[model samples]
Target: MKKYPKYKSSGISWLGDIPEHWEVRRNKYIFQERNEKSVKGTEELLTVSQYTGITKRKDKVLGENKLLTNASSLEGYKTVHKNDLVINIMLAWNGSLGISPYHGITSPAYSVFSIRNKNENFSNFFHYTFRTKIYHSIFKTVSTGVIDSRLRLYPDDFFKLTTLLPPLQEQIQIARFLDWKVGQINKFIKTKKHILELLKEQKQVIINDVVTGKIDVRTGKPYPKYKASAVEWLGDIPEEWEVLPIKRLSKAVKTGSTPPGADDKYYSSEGINWFTPGDFSDETELRNSKRQLSALGVSAVNIFPPKTVYMNGIGSIGKVGICLDSASCNQQINAIITNEKISPYYLLYCIKSAKQFIISFGKFTTLPIINQEETKSLIFPVPSKDGQKVIVSYIQEKTEATDRAISRIEREIELIKEYKERLIADVVTGILAIRGVEVPEVIEDIEEELPEDEPEEIENKEGVE
Candidate 1:
């Protein structure tokens, strides 16, 4: 990282100082808002995201949680062209804005703009600069809303903001330099992620083997006497183990419900912790949720006690977690109150080990779904209380080292991501100069480096904690 010989105050305070040769200009002078509205709206639909920037709607394979579909009629949608910058008015503060690589139609809720002087500037440079952490905070300050989620960055406010104006050639070079560096970083991350996935698969195998009685936890050897489990999934289990349907092992098997309407009053920041299928991940404990329900909302749903095991009944079928405290869940989840016959931890592992088998029970519709009756009918291999304890301990002891390795690699990925963000902030803001730095002739997708087609893919690739 190098700096120019001279520097000058930006006078904007938050902007601090910049290279003496650079100029600070209002966005209005640099960008002209495109107000063209489409009559037919037959062009490809476009979307902007904090992770992926601008993308064609069809490019993303969305999940049930955040499905994107076309409106009844595409009429009146805003028209976008290549090199145009699109901003989701309500989410601009969260970095949901980007320069489109394709000509398309976007939602009217977004504001579209194009650079006024293409020869003297580059949209890609601003795309990189604006997405930096500092700009996210700046957008938050300028956006107007009653709450954080509702904040909007309208054309007028966005145009009023000031930005650094690097020389045309410098802008291109800086963007090019960043593209090369980020690609190298992303490549390293991909490799680390592959290793992490293998570790997870290995752990899953261990859990599946012990919980299914495929392995004897007591002597670390095969069980002497194996019996036909009768259940096809549990072919041959220890003679002492029994195959029992979930309904037989639990006091109750209950499904959750959503409230009547979409009223915001039904939800609160300090409300009851409400779990959903999305809340269950690789972790065993279901501690918190993305959204909570107010008392009124809670009235419409059933709350299960702590230690209750939750299994996904829809969407991501078979994913499981246990509540660390009393919690209410949505319709997508099934809560099981295990009787003295089954330990919650053992039941949790049982559900996890039988994920693929449980998934098979789901009716393959537009999205896989399993109802309460089906969930209650799913069978598992059960052992006595003492046996269950031994299996649980065995799993903990066997997977502890693998879990630690996974955590270490995850933290390494997080640190690298943080470093990448900091590097972008410094370089784009002129804290580091790339004037004489040579950029490779060939660079990968510049703006397309971060965002992936699926949200889950992005989580596995760039997200780990």
Candidate 2:
């Protein structure tokens, strides 16, 4: 990275300093808010997202898009043209704003802006600059709101903010440099992400095999005597294994309740380990939650003892976690206190192995939910208590290395993303200059190398099934 020939103080605390040649201009002088609406509102719909920028609504396949059905006509929707910036005013503080590459209509609640000087190549420069955390922080400070999601970067206040305007040619060079550098970084990240996914899938297969008795973990061999599992998804199990419904194996299957939200006395910084599905990753133990419950809150809910397994019965269904200590969960979760016949760890693994089947019983309406009856009726393959212990221990030993590898790769991806963000901020702010720099030809057409499909059944070379 190289610096500019001269420097000057930006005066703005967020933007420390910039190249002396850069001009400090109010946004109003650089951009004009556009309010044009589609007469028919039939143009391709578009959306602004923190990750993807402005993309056609049809192209956003990862998440559900809420459509306005009550609108008698599309005439009220705002029109956005190419090169225009669309800001989801309420979500601007979260970086849900971007430059549009397609002509389309968006929700009327959004704010649209067009560069005032089209010849200046400022659109690309501003696109990167505005998305920086520094700019988002500024947006949050100026926006009128009590909380982040409610913050609104209105046209009046947005235009009042100052921006650093580098020379036209310099802005183009910086943008081009970033386009190449970020592409290279993203390629590396994609590769690591694919590896992480395969590792997780591999771990899931191991859990499925050991818990179902498909593999005898102690001897690293397939069970000699097997019988039909009766369930289609669960092919076969050891002849001695029993297939029983969850209701038969648990002393009690109960759901917890939330304390009254208006009562602040029920919440605390430290107390019982109150958990939600969001608090723990799948198959992990629940040690802590984002929100803890006071003694009163715990008393109001059903508090299960340690080693009890919690499964999310609604919303994100089938995510299983073991309670590390006595804990209470919200109504969305179902806690099972196992009987003497079943090991809690064994039951947890069985639930994880049959996750997809359990999830299939969920009724999808406004949200996905599995009623208590459905949860209790779900059957699983169960081995003897001693056998269950062996299986659980085997799974822990087998997947330890895979889990560590996944965590390391995930951390690497995070570092790469952080570096990408810093690189963009520094380049666009003129802290780093790309003057006469030669970008590699490989960067011009860099594409992510996708990981090969992982085998559904991973074979152990040492003869473990």
Candidate 3:
């Protein structure tokens, strides 16, 4: 990382100074808002992300969550061409804007703009610049909304912002240098993520074996007498254990709902803990939520008691957690308030072990879903209350070391991502010059490569809408 030979004031306070030869121009001079509507709803659908830039909507890995459809959605979608800048207007302040490398139709809600004077400017260079933290802050200042999530970056405001222009060759060189470096960094991230997956699998195996009686947690020895659990997935359990449907072990089994309407008054900064599938992770206990509901909102949804076992019933079906406190959830989750017959921790472990079985019920659906009836009917091997406690404690003690290791690895991945963001901002803003950097030839994964055909012709005739 090296600095430019000379620098000058950018006139833009946030930008401070830039390379002497670079030009500062209003975005109106650099980009024109694209208003082309898809004549036929046959183009590939695209989505913008803060993390990965522009990507095919279908290619996004949203766990088992598939995009739910609406009637004739792509019919009036905005058409985007290769290199056009696409912004998720509502999320522009969060860096949800990027240069599209594919020709596709995006949501009518998004704003699409084409680069002006393409021969003199490079889209990739500005793509890097616009997505930087500095620009995100700038977007926040100009965006119009009462709250952060609702902030919108309309076309007029975007056109008024000043942008930097580097020499065309230098822009190309910087973009190439970043492409190579980012590819290398991504490969490292992929490896780290794979390790995380393996660690999770290892923890799952331990839970699966202990909860299913494959491993005797009590005496660390084989059970003296074993009996067939009758349930196909349960296999066998200790002779004293009973295989019971969740409905029999819980006093109540029901679902929660979102409050009607999108009004801000329905939500509050200090409202009820409202859990959603998005709040879940690789943790047994569910606590904090990203959004909270007001007292009025609480009246619209069911409030389950503390220690209730909540299992995701739609999209990412089968993911389970026990509420650490009284909480409310959306309709996509089934709340099972257990009775004296079962230990909440043991129920959590059993449900975690049975995830694959629960998931199998929805494998053929467009979106994975297991309604309340289906969830209540699902069976689990249950032991005596005291026995369940012993097993839960044993499992927790055994998995403590593995959990610590997972946390450390997760932190490392977070730091690496932060570093990548900082590097992109520095290089794009001319703070760290890549003018003479010799970018190495990097071979990206086959999946990451763009199609060889003309982008506009790369169509998905049967669109999701």
Candidate 4:
């Protein structure tokens, strides 16, 4: 990357200086605010997102649904046209503004603007500019609200903000350069993400094989003999293994309850660990939680002893973790206190293997939930205490390498993403000169990394579960 031949300050402190040939103008001079509304309630509804630009509401693939009511009239809804910039007032600081590629209607709460400049290339240039970290900071300064999420960037305030504009021809070159460069970076990221997914899947397969006795860990070979378990999902297990209901193997199985709301006396920062499904992770043991309970809160709830296996019975069903210390949980979790017949670590693996089956028993409503009785009735394969210890040790040893590899790949992906963002910001803001620069040859040959000796014919199983 190279800098321009000469530079001059734009008089805006955040902008610093730009190429001498470029011009600075307020947004009002470059864009005309559009407030036209659709009379009919029907129009192709569109949504604005921070990840994706303006897209059909039905085409949104991420985030929760916020459109709760069906309005009888869309006369109050704003009409948006292709190439028009749409800003979600409340989320503009978070990069929820973008140039629309579709003609539609959006919530009246949003503001719409159309480029007034005739060059046509300015739209693409500004698209990248507005999404830069610099502009996001500027938006935060101008926005008004008590909290970040509630902040609004009104049309009046937006138009008053200063903008830097490159020459019409230079704007086109920069946009075209970025489109190619960013696309290559994104492809590299996608490849890394796929590799991370494969590592995780391999770990899961190893766990399943050891827990079900499909493979003997000590010998690293499949069992020669097997017997039908009669349970469909469990399929077949080693002849020596026995399947039993969870209730029979556990001394107690129960769910906790939340105390009354808004009671400060019952909540404290330095109390017993209060576990939630969100606190559960890939780790087998949980030593801490996002929120802790007060002594009063623990007294009002059941505090299970250390080593108790906890499974989410509601919402994120099947996530399991073992308490490293005495902990209390909300009503959404079911804790199992196993007897000497079962190893808590082994039970955790068994429940994890039967995740889909446990989820099937849940009642799907606004939130899915499995009652204590249903959880207790679920069947689990129990091996002798000695066998349980061996299986747990085998899984830990086999998965440690895979876990490290996955963590490394994940960290690499984050670094790559950060680089991509910085590159875009530098190029779009005129801090780096894209003109006359040749695209790197390495960008074209970036290949997806895969495990050694894996069959290319196998379908690429990508993404973490």
Instruction: List the candidates' TM-scores in order.
Output: 0.80, 0.80, 0.84, 0.70
Return the lDDT, model 1, position 315: 57
In model 2, the clashing pairs are none
- Better TM-score candidate (1, 4): 1
Tens-place lDDT digits, model 1, residues 364-404:
53345788899889899998999999999999989999988
* Model 4, span 187-222: residue lDDT tens: 888788778778867888888888888888768887
**After aligning candidate 1 to the native by TM-score, how far in Å is the CA of 46 from where it should be?**
3.1
1-465 per-residue lDDT for model 3 (tens digits): 789999999998999999999899999999999999987868998877666778886775234544523434568789999999999888788787899999988888889999889898899998889989899999999999876656888999999999888889988888888787777777777777778889889899988887888778867777888999889998889898899998899999999887775467778888888887777777888888888889888877788888988888875677788877888997878899999999988988888888888878654334567888887888999888888888888889988988888888878877877888899888888898886667767646311222211121112111223
lDDT of each: 0.82, 0.78, 0.80, 0.78
Evaluation by TM-score, superior candidate among 2 and 4:
2
Residue 242 of model 2 has an lDDT of 95
Q: Hey, what RMSD does candidate 2 come out at?
A: 7.8
| TM-score ranking, best first | 3, 2, 1, 4
The model with the greater TM-score, 1 or 3, is 3
lDDT of 3: 0.80
Please identify model 2 stretches exceeding 4 Å from their true place: 38-42, 62-75, 247-283, 286-317, 326-341, 364-377, 440-465
Predicted structure with the largest TM-score when compared to the true one: 3
Model 2 TM-score, 2 decimals? 0.80
Clashes of each: 0, 0, 0, 0
